[model samples]
Every structure is written in structure tokens, then in C-alpha cells.
Target: MTAMPPSSPDEPLQPQRFFAVVPAAGVGKRMGADRPKQYLVLRGRTLIEHTLERLCGFTPIERVIVALAAEDPYREGIAILNSSRVLCCEGGAERCHTVHSALNSLAGIAADSDWVLVHDVARPCVRVEDLQRLLDRLQGHPVGGLLGVPVWDTMKRTASDDQVIGTVDRQHLWRAYTPQMFRYGVLRDALSAVLARGELVTDEAAAIEAAGLKPLLVEGAQDNIKVTRPEDLALAEFYMAQQEAGQS
Candidate 1:
């Protein structure tokens, strides 16, 4: 992949459009549901629907791409799948593969310097304000970053035997959140290289880090949570209500 040329200090940077890629291929085994967690209902809508609506609602995001399993039976039923602003592609077995597939799908349409924000479909409480904040802060940054909350709870390290190893320092530690942003070319190259080496990357930030680049950390609301367990669905509903009330 060809890298975008760096802009000189004297030259004004060109404007880059924004795009969103949501990886929704996972079965979410931890949720223990009959179907993927994203296919489950939340406030009368599927989790994937909420996620797609939230991302599509953000005005700055020109397009939203979703990567889904090849045989995902529920996708065609969602009306949003037919929307012009959203596109769907065949996803892989893993999150990294799904993301890479989405990125590849955008190759002809998105410019190398354009920004792509990778978010989780399980995170329905992500606020538009936070999304704007992240884009605002990292617009011209060399390496884009993600929205995260600072760790506030006391932490501990554990041994394989389930014994407490030691009290861990929480200083400078942040709980990573979604909408991790990076340039199209940079992210594609980073993910490609990392996956090629058979490395495991939990998020886009880790992939960027593996490419030897420091991604910026933009502070965001702690309520922007990913729904994993059944209890998390209720909490996400509460947060979503709060966000809606605030918006009203």
C-alpha cells in the first residue's frame, strides 16, 4: 500500500472525508445468546441496527461500512442494509479479518489520506458528541487515536492459579473504547502487516502500535460501554436513555 505523502509545515493540509467501519461478524459467545449479540434486540431494535443508526447519524461520517459473516441470515431483513450511505461486505472468522475486509472494500472509494473510524457494534451508547470530539482533536494529527476512559478503580494482578499476585498501579492506565480512528492507508498497512505475521490484535490501536506508531488517547465518557454479558444490555439501555434525555 502506498503511503500518503506528508504535508510540509508551510503547505496547508487537504481536507479528508470521514468513514466508519463496524465489525459485526462475531458470534459474541460470551453473551450466550442463540444468535450473535448484535442481532439481539435492544429497545425494540437490533443491536447492529442501533450501532448503524448511531454511526450513520453522525453528519461528518460520509459513509458507513459493515462487515458481516457470509451466511448471516439476519442482515437482509434490516432495512438499513438497503440504505445508500451504508455498504455491507463479507467478513472473516476474526475481528481483525473483518476490519481488513471492510477496509479493502473501501479501497476504490476512499482516499489514502481519508480517516476511518473503527467502532464496535456492541457499543450502542457511544454519543455523537464524543464522536465529534475525537474527530476534532485528531483531524490533523499524524497518528489518529481512540476514545477511552481513565482507569479509576483499584487494580490487581492475578496468577494462573487464581491467586492475587500483587496490587497493580493504575496510573496512566486507560480503558480503551471504540471509534478508534486512523488514516486509511496507515491502518490498512498496519493491520495487513500485523495479521500477516500471525499476530493477535484486539483493536485498531494495537495494530497501529505494532507498526511502531503512537496513537493519541482522547478522553471520552465512561458510559460508552460494549455490551458483552446479559447484565451489560441493561446497563447499555440505561446509558442510552440518559444520552437521549441529555440530547432532548
Candidate 2:
């Protein structure tokens, strides 16, 4: 991991720019789609288009970097991909690798103190207000946080044999969503270290946690769902409709 220089206490803080990174390399095998799930259409636009629109529309996001597969053919046809504010890079086999690739691509452009908001391409229903809230709440925070929702359901611990081992407590538990925000340099170094150790991290927060950092959890709307299975498409569509109608 690359070491970042310590900041002087008397020095004034530098203005930090915000950037968005979308990892869209997954094939979404669980969705059982012929193409990558991001290429699937929702309403009149592709899922990737809607996701990008939301991120690009956010005023604070200076740039949006999309990590795509090397052999991806669908992105070429998307008109929005031609936007100057949006850039693309070759993705890796897993989500963490894809994110790291996007970060590396921004090496010359984004500063270490800048913030990177890592969002999922499948989650098209992320509310604009919720995104603003996240940025607003995390301002001046040393360790950046992520948008998530508290767990409401009864928790359980199960065994490999599909047997219930015991009941678990759900107090203070959260179902993490994205965009998970973190300092560009911190995230890059943490992810690189974790990957180099041959460990798996489900999200940016996990990688930061392994580096002995605790990220704040900002509660967001429950509708910010990642489209994983076939049924989730319909649910996302419904949520998007509600958002468009100004009801969500």
C-alpha cells in the first residue's frame, strides 16, 4: 500500500472534489440475462443509462468513471457514453478489482484528498436528495461513510445444512447500500492491500474496516435496491416510477 503524507495541523484544508465510480463488469448470472445486467433496459433507457444519469446529474460529482469489461459491446451504442464528463476503463474479474481499476485510471486526474463515491450500476432508484444528504452529512468527516438502511427483519444464524443454528440480534445492524464514499487515496490503498492479501471484501467499507477504520453509516431510503435477480427488476421499475412521480 502506498503511504500518504501526514497533514500539518496548522495548514488549511484543501478543497476536495467529488467523483463517482461505477463498476459494471459483472455478468449478473443470477439475473439470468443474456447480456450483462447493466445493459438490460428499464423503462425507455438501459439500466446503466439511468444509473449514470443520476450520478451525472448530481451537481457535486465532477466526473463519473465507469469500469466495464474489455469485451463489452453494449456501451458503444449508448449515446450518453460519449459525454465528456463520463469516462471508461477496463474492469477486472470481481467488483473490488473493477473499483481499483477505475481508481487507478484516475491517478493523474483525481487528488488523494478528493472523495470517491462508489455506486452500483444496478441501483437506478437512488434518490437525488438522498445522495445530497450523504455528501452533506459527511462533510469534514475524516473517515467517509456509506448510505445504508437499518435491518428490520428478525435475524438468524444458519448452518451449511440449511438448519437454523441460533437466533441473532439485529440491534444496530444495517443493510449496506451505495454510493460508499471514501477518500481516494485511502480507498485505493486499502483495496490494494486487501486484494494483495488474497482476501474478499463485499464493499469499500469492508476494505476500510480491515485497515482499522470505521466508516459512518448514513441511513438512506429503502428503495435504493441493487437489481440482482429477475424479480428485482420489476421492483426497481416500480420504485423508479414512484421517484419520477415525486412520491418516493
Candidate 3:
């Protein structure tokens, strides 16, 4: 695997100003877990802690802001957070709502021109180099961008009866990944439009696309999968070890 380029803190890159909003409010019912996925232990730290460490380590990111559930038990995570540079805010009932709350915490609040990266707390495997690439690509774009992997495997269109209805044209199909980057004001308006239409967006990219803005997709690492099931934690742990080994 090709390694991500190391970003130097002393030589901080200009042009890209990154402010991430990580949403970790969803109860992982599918995982059949007792706690939220972000709070789950991975490699001696909470998954979120690992994510924040990397995000803050990158020089381009101005700040790391997390949107957590209102009733999240904090004492266990407090000291870990105190050791890092991330700021925390209360999340709302829905994903978009939480993002709105988190963005409100931004002092100046981004003008329509500023950029915001909406990342998934569960997607802890997002690589700094890949993120940097996406940031670089977004600088000149008319709208913004998202990190995604091309569809390499044949896709199936399933029917209600669990039978394959037809084969999908997988040539240009790809799964969207978070750290979905976008212009702050455009995203805000897009999200507002989604709310107005009473539609549920699986990710911020949907909202941006709904606003008639094109978000370019950058090729992302395939290992950067969102953690959902218990087994996924094991895979994420292995990926983490691979990352540390690479850095070493």
C-alpha cells in the first residue's frame, strides 16, 4: 500500500482551512452493543480518542470539534479528551441537527465561502494523507468534494424476496465515505433544504447534492470503513496496527 505523505506542523499548508464536525450520537442498535460505537475500546483507547488524535495531529486542521449525545457519560472520556486538543459539543436528536449545533460553536461561523469537513466518528481509519489529498483537490473546485472508493466488485440489485432482480452497472458506482468536505454556507443551506423537504440524508453528501451542487469524489483508502458491528472493531484494530507499523 502507498503511504500517506507526512504533514509538517512547522510548515503548515495554506489554502485549506479544515474544521471537522464528528457526529457520535447514534445508538448502535445493529451492533447489539451496550454503548455507542465511538465509546467502544480499540487499541487501549476509545475509537473517538484515536480519531481525534490523528485529526488534531494534522497541521491543516484548525480545530477538532465533536458532536456527542446530550446524555453521554463523560467522566470516563474526560481525561482522555483533556489530553488532546479537541472541543466537545452536545449533539441533537438527528444527524443534521447535531451538525448544526456543532457548527454554531464556530465563533465566526463559516461564511458561504468557507469549508467544513463532516466526518464520521465511527470511520476511525481515515488516513491523514488521503484527507490532505481531498483538501488539496477541493481548493479550486466550484463546490466541494467527498472521499470514496470505486466499485471494484460486481453489484447486485436485490428484490423484496431476497432474490437478485438484476445486475447493477458498477462502472462508476462507488460507496461514499465521510470526511465529506463541503463549503460551510452551501452545506448549511443544503441541510436546510433537506429539512424543508422532510428527507433523511444518510450523509452530508446527499444534502449537498440535493442543493444542486456537484461534490467531486476523491479516491479514498478501502480500509477506511465505518465501524458498526462488533466484528468491525476487530478489523478496525488490525487496520490501526497496520497504520502504526507504517509510521514506525
Q: What is the TM-score of each candidate against the true structure?
A: 0.96, 0.95, 0.88
lDDT at position 20, candidate 2:
97
Rank by TM-score (best first): 1, 2, 3
User: lDDT by residue for model 2 over 106-200, one digit each (tens)?
Assistant: 99899888899999999999989889999989887777899999999999899999799998899999999999999898899899999999998
Worst 10 residues of 2 by lDDT: 1-10
Deviation from native of the Cα of residue 119 in model 1, angstroms: 0.4
lDDT of 1 by residue, 84-183 (tens): 9999998998999999999999999998789999999999988898999999899678778999999999999999998999988999999999999999
Residue range 17-89, candidate 3, lDDT tens digits: 6688888777778888777878888888888887777777778777777888876884254464564457778
* Candidate 2 local distance difference test against the native: 0.91
**Higher TM-score: candidate 2 or 3?**
2
Inter-residue clash pairs, candidate 1: none
> Residue 195 CA error for candidate 3 (Å)?
1.0
Superpose all Cα atoms of candidate 2 onto the true structure and report the RMSD in Å to 1 decimal.
1.9
